[model samples]
Target: MRMLLNIRIPHEPFNAFVRDGTIEEVMAKIPEAMKPEAAYFTEQSGGRGAILVINPDEPSQTPAFAEPWFLTFNADCEFRVVLLPEDLQKAGLEMLGSKWK
Candidate 1:
């Protein structure tokens, strides 16, 4: 089944992932956002912004709030994986299994 793995990593780690191509591997065949990598938007005053990783195949025609930059993941089924910043390393290790170096 296809899945969307949403991960939250520290700014440094996120940059490293992009540099090392880990992000590419995770999203499989999909297009990433342009510059500024991370997008931010506020729903209300004093509200924190969110980072969004979208699935390319699941397109929505309607206009929506902007923020949490959009990333498209080409997958066949619907799935969600949410990981916190601290769990990135462990989660990556698990995804790659023992063969990952």
Candidate 2:
């Protein structure tokens, strides 16, 4: 399944890395390691943020993704299951709605 990885990096820690000139290396290294299908960076109200669409084989694999951010930047990471348009169509929503109704 495809999952969305929402990462929030706090300003203080992120700024420290920037000042130390480690941000470029650290930032580049993560995506290289994870090899996400898609990755995007943006700013969140709390700090810097990223949204990554990745495929992890099992539940045990969450740490493999989240730990890097946690230990590196004291970041917060959230994972949510995502469905493609085809996946939604195959979900049998109409069948479920009729069953429930």
lDDT of 2 by residue, 1-101 (tens): 79999999888788988999999999999889999999999988856999999999998988999999998889999999999999999999999999999
Cα lDDT tens digits, model 1, 1-101, are 11233323334544565788786564432324322223343332333223443333333311121222232222112225445567676566766876765
TM-scores vs. true structure, each candidate: 0.20, 0.94
RMSD of 1: 16.8
Residue 82 in candidate 2, Cα distance off native in Å: 0.6
Q: What is residue 77's positional error in candidate 1, in angstroms?
A: 24
Candidate 2 residues lying further than 4 Å off, grouped into runs, are: none
Regions of model 1 farther than 4 Å from truth:
1-8, 27-101
Candidate 1 — what's its lDDT?
0.36
In model 2, which residue pairs have backbone atoms overlapping below 3 Å? Answer: none
